[model samples]
Target: MEIKLVPVRPEDKGTLINLYQLYEHDFSRFTNRDIDKNGRYEVNIDFYWEGDERWNPFYIEVSGTIAGFLVVLFENMDIDPDPTHVIYDFMILQKYRRTGIGRAAAIKAFKMYNADWAVTQMENNTPAISFWRNVIKSFKEDNFTERYRPERKKYIQELSTKT
Candidate 1:
């Protein structure tokens, strides 16, 4: 399975919507809330409008099909620091799980952006936690931090590495 990163275009709205719905459904399993409510599901659309100046989105293609997507948000501290990229969301279709597509996509994103990237996984998703653990292990240079928020019963794992 050859994976490639394709820049997200306006014409890809349908595919992005489909992926967003799938991501929302998957997220609901851990949050126990319908994220589609209040049209929050349109966040991706908004991100697209916001343009690549700050956030950039990519479609992960495998065997010519869009198997997943990833969004990178660029940030800088104060006015003198170099910019860093964060993986705001990454989702691979259930059928494609464990196929190495996700890892390839992540590596591609890291190389394409050539900056630090971070991902946060909720504590409830043990599978995701383990998945990220392995990712960090394989990368071996990223720093991982765990933070707990009692109000939301959410645990966040932040991982980052310099390119």
Candidate 2:
């Protein structure tokens, strides 16, 4: 399958909503809690499109369908107090995963940014943790650290390796 990264537009709001729902649903399955309220979720998504400086959302198109979404957030590092970009969220539809699409999209995003990038996955989401571990392992410099958040019961994996 061909993967394309496209700039998200206002017209793509519905598609973005669907993608967000997919994430919320999967996340709920792992955490056993609803992270989003019905109407409130849409509001948050709309806010992102309404010029949220922190988040830059993009559409991941596979073939002709909008398979998922990715958000690159400009954030300050907790350890070093330096500005950096983080892959805030990334999700591909269940049917479209494990076909190299996710890795391809990641590589594309890395090339486009040409800087240190980071991604965090929930600890219960073993597949995602494993996927990220493999990706980091393949790199020459796996500059990453995992921090456990007792309050959230999740491990935040931060990667700064970019080749």
Candidate 3:
């Protein structure tokens, strides 16, 4: 289970888009997301291509296989104002679920930044909530805050590695 987070290149945008479809499909269960007439869900990976230093995209590879993807967002990046590295998107294929690959990738992503972190999950997504809680707790013990944001309808876990 050698997990590596490879920085996604501009030429790999298509791969990211394809992987995003899967991520969105899985997320649709909790968000009730609907696809357009084209039979494809609209996802915004545009920010990753905006040449911003804050938006990072990575391909989660396990033993040279593309297992999933992760996007880390730095605060002050146009889309979000939170003062922390945000876990914008993360997904592991069905075959890789519950196998620790995702947890490993997530922890790797967190270690890439030495600042605070914010991991959010749709309010109805219990599995995501559990996954993030376990990962953050194992990474930083009980030094994080978990709160629900009514306006956004999501549960956000905020933690700091600086202290």
Colliding residue pairs in candidate 2: none
Better of 1 and 2 by lDDT: 1
Clashing pairs in 1: none
Candidate 2 structure quality by residue, lDDT tens digits, 1-163:
6888887787877778778877877777776755545443332577666666667788888886777778887775435445578888888889888888787777666666646666777778888888777766555245676677878776676666445
**Backbone steric clashes in candidate 2, count:** 0
Q: Ten residues in a row with the worst lDDT in model 1?
A: 35-44
- lDDT tens digits, residue span 83-109, model 3: 578998898999999999999999998
| lDDT scores of the candidates, listed in order | 0.73, 0.72, 0.89
RMSD of 3: 2.3
In model 3, pairs of residues that clash are none
lDDT, candidate 1, 31-91, per-residue tens? 6765555655444466565544666778899989989898887765335266767777889
Instruction: Estimate the TM-score for candidate 3.
Output: 0.92
lDDT of 2 at 52: 60
